[model samples]
Target: MTRPVATKVAFEDGWKAADTITLDETARYRRRMVMTSDNGVEFLLDLGEARLLRHGDGLVLDDGRVIEVHAAPEKLYRVAAQDPHHMLRLAWHLGNRHCPSQIMEDCMLIRRDHTLRAMLEGLGAAVTEIEAAFDPEGGAYGESHGQHGHHHGHHHD
Candidate 1:
């Protein structure tokens, strides 16, 4: 039976659609959702069941669950991008998604983090230190050099 599709997402600060969202067809779910509105804001999103099937080019859920779409990945992506709660529920199920109350805490931590990381990078800490704050484990941290820290960067590595 198709489980009832309850609210899959709840924004911390009631974000306007089209701001921090993007769709992923082959991934079988919402790809990039910048979790802002709470406080500090971070670019991270939960993965939905839509991505749980083939287990190949799928989204590795925030819960550390790998879900690849074997059927209609694109349709599922539309469903997740249009609605946020269901996507958020996917995170809740993973046991990593934060609660409304914790939103503030997460924000505070993330903001301080970015600030410190920026400061560290500004102070000329090794590229590794800066990357650690933004992207740990030497993964694709991918930071675009910005002028005033706005999303837009004039120069990119």
Candidate 2:
């Protein structure tokens, strides 16, 4: 059977999805792939390049059906500094290590690692474990998944 093709994209509040595709951080980025929804609805996501799909982006099928993309929950570390200056310093260190981190206003989230945990603690940043959707910055040069692809206000609660 020819799977439904999703060519258009929608931001979180724009479209109501007929179904949802929960994907981990790694599986979310793709130019072409077959995805099966929770209800067993299968489709093709051909974005033409690897793009980071955030929690509420939708894939619009040719038949006007929408499949919402949800960021799957994962174990991560929440890091916070005592002050803004310290936070900036910690961010720099994480960036230097090429860590994939979700930079929030008050804290940052990264995949938990003992070495990284130790480093952050030594740097005077508090580290805590949390379970949430992991949506890190793509990079200096990365594909903008769709409209409002820039994750400005999206963060863990």
> Best by TM-score, which number?
2
TM-score of each: 0.16, 0.91
For every model in order, what is the number of clashing pairs? 14, 0
Q: Which portions of model 1 show Cα errors greater than 4 Å?
A: 4-113, 125-157
Looking at candidate 1, what is the lDDT of residue 61? 30
Best by lDDT: 2
Looking at model 2, residue 84 earns an lDDT score of 97
**Model 1: lowest-lDDT 10 consecutive positions:** 130-139
lDDT for each residue of candidate 1 in 1-157, tens digit (9 for 90 to 100): 2211212342123222322222222232333443331222233444342221121223233333322222221210001112354434332432332211111111111112344444434533322211101110111234221111222111111
Candidate 2 C-alpha lDDT tens digits along 1-157: 6889987677747677899989888888777887898789998888766677777788888889998888899999999999999999999999999999988889999999999999999999999999989988767655553335555365686
Clashing pairs in 2: none
